[model samples]
Target: MTPQQEPPPFLGTWARVYWGVVLYLAAVIGVLMLFTASFRL
Candidate 1:
């Protein structure tokens, strides 16, 4: 099999990776909302 079958180095598990992505997306959305509110957009 290819290296894709192995787990990530830092996070280790795919579940953690998924959660990390979710958190990142949430953070980005939160920042955009704050920016929009500040600009009254």
Candidate 2:
């Protein structure tokens, strides 16, 4: 048997790694902002 390598399941390419990282950061930032606003009250 031989080994095989595959890219991201959804993105289908290595570029998805960078995209995923950026999207994750954006999501985290958005969540933090919401928390900050809620606490400011």
Candidate 3:
């Protein structure tokens, strides 16, 4: 027998939510790097 799992509230499923978090972090880091470079120039 298999256990039934519930989907997350936003983003459809848990996996999508995880990927969304990853992408958000990457975007934040990219923006931070851009700011750092602009300030250093």
Candidate 4:
């Protein structure tokens, strides 16, 4: 008997979701910084 190994199918989907969250957070932080900088100037 031989054992077979296969990669998980949800790996790609989860990776994309994780990246999306990171990008969204970065955008939000950037907007906040811009707003704060404009107010300070």
Candidate 5:
């Protein structure tokens, strides 16, 4: 027997939530890289 699971609160599905988190992490990394590059001499 299998147990029922609940959907993510925001994105509705687990896959979408995972993708959203990935995209958010990528964006944050990109911004941080840019910030670091600008400060480099």
Candidate 6:
């Protein structure tokens, strides 16, 4: 008989959520940087 593999845990879900938040923050920071650079004389 073949051994059965266990399903992945909730950590994967948490990791995805964490990654999404990080990407969102990075996007916001990038936009702010662009805005500030545009305002510079």
Which number leads on lDDT? 1
Shift in Å, residue 28, candidate 6:
0.4
- Candidate 1 lowest-lDDT run of ten: 1-10
lDDT of 2 by residue, 1-41 (tens): 33346555677766887888899999999999998899885
**TM-score top scorer:** 5
Clashing pairs in 4: none
lDDT of each: 0.91, 0.81, 0.89, 0.73, 0.89, 0.75
- Stretches off by above 4 angstroms in model 1 are 1-4
Model 4 segments beyond 4 Å from truth?
1-12
Residue 41, model 4: Cα distance from true site in angstroms: 2.6
Flag regions of model 6 displaced more than 4 Å: 1-12
**Candidate 1, 1-41: lDDT as tens digits:** 57988888769898999999999999999999998899874
Sorting all predicted structures by lDDT, with the top scorer first, yields 1, 5, 3, 2, 6, 4
Candidate 2 — worst ten consecutive residues by lDDT sum? 1-10
Error of 6 at 35 (Å): 0.7
**lDDT, residue 36, model 6:** 95
Model 3, residue 14: C-alpha shift (Å): 0.7
For each predicted model, how many residue pairs clash, with residues at least 3 apart or on different chains? 0, 0, 0, 0, 0, 0
Model 5 residue 5 distance off true place after TM-score fit, in angstroms: 1.2
lDDT of candidate 3 over 1-41, digit per residue (tens) = 33457777898988999999999999999999998899884
Residue 5 lDDT in candidate 5: 75
